[model samples]
Target: MPNAIEFLFDVGSPTAYLAWHRLQGIVARTGAALIPVPILLGGVFKATGGSPPGTVAAKGRWMNEDMQRWAARDGVVLAMNPYFPINTLTMMRVLAGLEGDSRFGGVVNTLFAGMWQQGLNMADTQVLTGVLTAGGHDAHGLLALAQSPDVKARLIANTEAAVALGVFGAPTCFVAGQMHFGQDRLDWVEAAAAG
Candidate 1:
């Protein structure tokens, strides 16, 4: 068996959501622990000179189509959020704040579904609160924690560490010290874990 798989991801990326959806089964089969590392995609972009897919019109359209095809292949529901490129600073901070909490996984699931399945405007604080409440999280407390300096610093550190590790985008995975970027490379991730 391999070491724990590190999943460095941002919620704003639908491909990351797709990776999250498939990780559980992969881990179950491979007996590898799945570690979720919340990183700000924007920070990674800035550090790595990368930009979001929406920056290019044709690429954006093709990417959406590709996401749809992958969703169909994986039997996962993915509705493109109308508010594309929603600023994820607050969300990532909240995730960092909840880093070691038992409810972290639940929060991750709720937020991912809210963004990629329910098409919620995750950039809006009110909308985020409602989604979190509906998901049974303590929205007020979580939001409060998200604003703390510690959480912000943790997120920044995570993003910087990811960049230092050669990550340039969301859904970057590390299995057995081998890096795999993008949801399309999940097969490689499984193989690495199985070895």
Candidate 2:
């Protein structure tokens, strides 16, 4: 069986972006299937009784610098997203639609670039439509699908499933059933994959 790596992420997370960038190389080296699981960090925080970084000044301040260092090392341009920590419902919905897509990686990369590097307001219908269409997905149908009751339920279920898996933040990586959280933990993740 092919090794699987499940990645739970939210777009508002710089950590997620950093981890996302790092995963490509890890997948190549380890030959693990990259599985992206979209989950809401805000909801996860609530479920885990945690608060956003801004609510805790000391750690938040340190994380800001840490993020820059990781971005520099990873070579992923780290421009602060203008609309960040923006609601990722639409982004997640779009990604969920791509879960089974043949162009999954392309779609994920485009969404990350659009929201993080390009500073597009991901919540904007037109912006999302454009991103999907540009990526060759049906924009109009996706927009409607994103708002459908079924999609909403699935997104919530996604978050609940993440919580059940003991996820408390974005960028949680599950390798061979062992969980590794954060970009700083890549070494252990790689080890898990190797073993």
Candidate 3:
């Protein structure tokens, strides 16, 4: 049986989006199941004392350049979100609520592209609503579901589980029980999944 690759992700991370974009091809070639685990990056940061690259001016500049290089190398469209460090709590909650639904993949793609490619400021509820609605999702329903206690709890649980698994950053992947951090580590992830 092929291995199941667990992708622990937060949409706020551009590197996570890059990893996610490449993971589809890896999964297809390796015949591995891609399991998406939605976690709050902020929660993980707080739990693990992890800080965003933007916290340091030089690191943030370097990271942006690196992301641009990766995007060009991958031939993927990635624009730096003008509203950097947008709060994604509600969006993550909505993703948690949509888990297992057939529309989950579409929702993920829509949100990722909206934030990373289209420069949508998803941190604003009104902006998110418009973007999601335009993407064919029932924005009102998703927003309502996101506010539900169950969905909120699930997101919290996911974040806690990620921390327990030693995930200090976004775009962490698990292949055959081995943890791989960052989009740059995806080659190892593909090799592990192929085994």
Candidate 4:
């Protein structure tokens, strides 16, 4: 896994979605493999006693505006989810279940695109199923798999692993053990990957 970029993220994070797009460019440029580690932002927050900047009214407004600017700068479409602060427990479990399966990336793309690009309220089971079906997946099967014991454990472990790596937020990247936090830190991430 040397020269690999470990992207610790959650689909619920707008910046994580942006970093998800930007990191691929670095992967293509550096010939470094991208490893996605799906973790729960709420779990991270609970563990770290760290609150998202958007929790405060002023910070919420500023972060929303800033996120839009970053999206425009990166040529990525970012429609803020109408159902912000979604409970991603089930979604993350589905992702964890899909890990190592060929369907993982597609599902990740589906969920992130659904949540961040299309402004879909993924909290609704009906909407979630429709989104996955549109993405060419067996929605019910995936959701069933998510309910299994092992998949739930994997998500918890991933969050713990992220915390152990000192990740307080989503969009964290580590190249050769060097930590680069935030979507805006792509430069340092690329440099470390190249190094």
Candidate 5:
């Protein structure tokens, strides 16, 4: 097996949501392992001097349109959440907690779907716990683990690592040590994987 593709993402980013939806096909076709690294987007922004797309009104508007089209084409739901800038720390830590659990992958997939497709606010404790429980995890246990100091530190460390790696955006794919930002660059990611 080849080295896994390191997928750095934050749940609050629509771009990351789009990439998450598209990644399943890429992993299947390329036979590449997917290493999901959930980070705080704000931390990444601070560390990398990157600005969120929403800062640019014109660009952000067009991006939302493009994203809607793409999501529809891919058969993924794209309901815009009212919480444009939701705090993702809670959700990220929960994801980190699922790291070694047998339910890790399932929880990740379902939670992403819950946010991007179902418009669920993952930051809310009730919503998070419900999603985890529905996905067959011990919600209370997972939440307790997620809230631990270790998980919080690791999430921060992950954000710092992404910045150190020169990643300035969400949905960045690190394949063969080269960073490919955005779903539009999946072709390049595929080429890199092919070799």
Candidate 6:
């Protein structure tokens, strides 16, 4: 994937959501493919003794303002979900299950928008159903797939692999084996791709 960016993400991360959208523009500009790597952020934190920046109250407020600045600068919509730090076990399982499906990208976009753009609580079973159904997916089927042992295993493996790669948080990108964290480092990612 020298010509691609392995995008490690969690559906619950607003920064990763912003990074995802900017990476789309990077794909267009650099012609570098985005290899999506869905993982559980909670697992990463547990394994690495790391935590999201929002864990501290003042840091959380500052980070909110910072996130808003990034979103506005990137010209993407981002409203902080009132329910921050949601349990995304089921949601990430669904993403991992969609790995090879043709609808994966659309589904990812829908889920990201549902969480960040519209500021919906994606952890809610009913809200998720409405989002998926409105996004043209058979909600019941996807939910069923998420419960499969294989899908659950895949997410765990991905999370472990991420930890192995020194990935301490969401939106970690690898370009030619160089790791860059955060959405603000997208220029370096683009430069790595162009190389």
Poorest stretch of ten by lDDT in candidate 6: 1-10
Query: Where does candidate 2 have its weakest 10-residue lDDT segment?
Result: 94-103
Residue-level lDDT of model 2, residues 151-186, one tens digit each, is 777778989999998988878989888999887998
Q: lDDT of all the models against the reference? A: 0.93, 0.80, 0.93, 0.90, 0.81, 0.92
Each prediction's TM-score versus the true structure: 0.97, 0.89, 0.98, 0.96, 0.91, 0.97
Model 4 worst lDDT run, 10 consecutive residues? 1-10
Ranking 4 against 6 by lDDT, winner: 6
Deviation from truth (RMSD, Å), model 6: 1.2
Give the TM-score comparing model 4 with the true structure, all chains together: 0.96
User: Model 6, clash count?
Assistant: 0
Candidate 4 residue lDDT tens string, 33-93? 8888889999999999997777899989988899899999989999988798888888999
lDDT of 5: 0.81
The true-versus-predicted C-alpha distance at residue 31 of model 2, in Å, is 0.9
The residue pairs in collision within model 2 are none
Of 1 and 4, the candidate ahead on lDDT is 1
Rank candidates, TM-score, best first: 3, 1, 6, 4, 5, 2
Q: How accurate locally is residue 195 in candidate 4, as Cα lDDT from 0 to 100?
A: 76
- Once fitted onto the true fold, the runs of candidate 1 whose alpha carbons sit more than 4 angstroms away are none
Task: Give the clashing residue pairs of candidate 6, or none.
Answer: none
Compose the digit string of candidate 6's lDDT tens values, residues 8-119.
9998999999999999889998888889989999999999999889889899999999999999998999999999888888889999999978888898998998999888
Q: Write the per-residue lDDT of candidate 5 for residues 11-127, one digit (tens) a residue.
A: 788878878778888888888888888878888888767788877999888988999988888887888876667777888887776666677678777777777777887788898
Mark the 10 consecutive residues where model 3 has the least summed lDDT.
1-10
